[model samples]
Target: MPFGKVPVLEIDGKVLNQSTAITRYLSKKAGLAGSDDWESLLIDIAVDNIHDLRQEIASYFYDPNEVTREAKYAPLINETIPFYMDKFEKTVEENNGYFVNGKLSWADLFFVAILSYLNSSVKIDLLEGRPKLRALKEQVLAVPQIKAWVAKRPTDIP
Candidate 1:
């Protein structure tokens, strides 16, 4: 596999690595990218920002040293999470419960998809008090295709 990764996707005998690249390609084909170039740009911005936040969470959660891990937790919970979540909540609220263009895009699906992993890493409900974010989660999960997929997808991972 290219990059020796599990997420590599092979289509028409061509291999694609990296989750973001694969997701973007599928999103475009699935009509979830955006309505136009500008909207797609906005979706890309949101997805990139989400990726940055995920990197921060992963850095703290994956550190093997207990003391350093403990040290990172406080700032992550107190500052990092709220800083990002608040902006995300506001964006969702402004966009009428979607990440961009007031409609469902790959960005919304991306955030909702990784939320459980984020919560598991942090050991807390990241959307606990954020109503808009909670609504956004509900909105995405309520999609018939996503709902069916969630019901049938393997639950082996936490």
Candidate 2:
């Protein structure tokens, strides 16, 4: 806290670190949050379960550490990303169109973010063989704000 970066959430002049923790806190404040209960646990599970894999997949595609032919993308394409994506799809369906509940929440936003990542960085035919999941994503995408975001979303990320 003595010599840290900007965007500090000081409580009585105490700085807070950890971006994920801070985002989680803010998600709660906005009601786009989750609970500590069992069912609510899935929300965190779903988000975390996919983040690392998605990041790795993105790095594979866009990171200069990666080459032009998508060599780093093999594992993700052949196994990892699809595996977790399928799990999330099932989780969404099993929970009845939401990640861990019956309403749109942070989990939906998480899914949308991940889908955007997939569309930009990789070729994920999300609905190709998973019609239900595709339809679910489409349904979420149809919402006005999110839809506008998607329409104006940037495809070029370096």
Candidate 3:
């Protein structure tokens, strides 16, 4: 009943119940998706991946089944993290050592979030030997605005 109904894009009369679609549209309109198609795709991938992983993590936290808990997080602790480390390293190296589009992009932000997850949740050195990954994390955090935001993010967003 807020807004007296669903929020509508009155300019063209588009209606969406979901927040993701609306944000994507606003992103395009605001020039934040970037100047080119690859850049926009990179942004989409990063945003979608964030949604995917965070959902899994939420389930990991709330799953009442022990088997489900182990299954949900074991791959996170053992496999997926290492996979991301290797994959992101190679992607950075092959893409001239930039996260996306030969420059820092939302993909890097995803990397940072993943790193933060690992740092906050895992005791193991999941990022060990991944200097490039380390550098990438540092690079993203070195941005003053992002640094402040990271500081503001909760330790347990699970």
Best by TM-score: 1
Candidate 2 lowest-lDDT run of ten: 1-10
lDDT of 1 by residue, 9-86 (tens): 999999889989899999999999988999999999999999999999999999999999999999999999999999
TM-scores for candidates 1 onward, in order: 0.97, 0.68, 0.62
Candidate 2 local distance difference test against the native = 0.69
Per-residue C-alpha lDDT of model 3 across residues 1-158, encoded as one tens digit per residue: 22565544544554444555665676567555657887888777766755665565566666889898877787776766666557767767766656666676656655575665655554566458877767777887897887897689887652
Displacement of residue 57 (Cα, Å) in model 1 is 0.5
| Candidate 2 C-alpha lDDT tens digits along 1-158 | 54476545766677787656666676788776765566457667777876776676767776675365466667777787678767877877787887777666676776665675576677666445666567677778888987898778786731
Residue pairs with clashing backbones, model 3: none
Provide the overall lDDT of each model, using Cα atoms, as 2-decimal numbers. Answer: 0.94, 0.69, 0.65
Highest lDDT scorer: 1
Q: Model 1 segments beyond 4 Å from truth?
A: none
Better of 1 and 2 by lDDT: 1
Once all C-alphas are superposed, what RMSD does model 2 give against the true structure? Answer: 4.3
Candidate 2 Cα outliers beyond 4 Å, as residue runs: 1-19, 62-70, 148-158
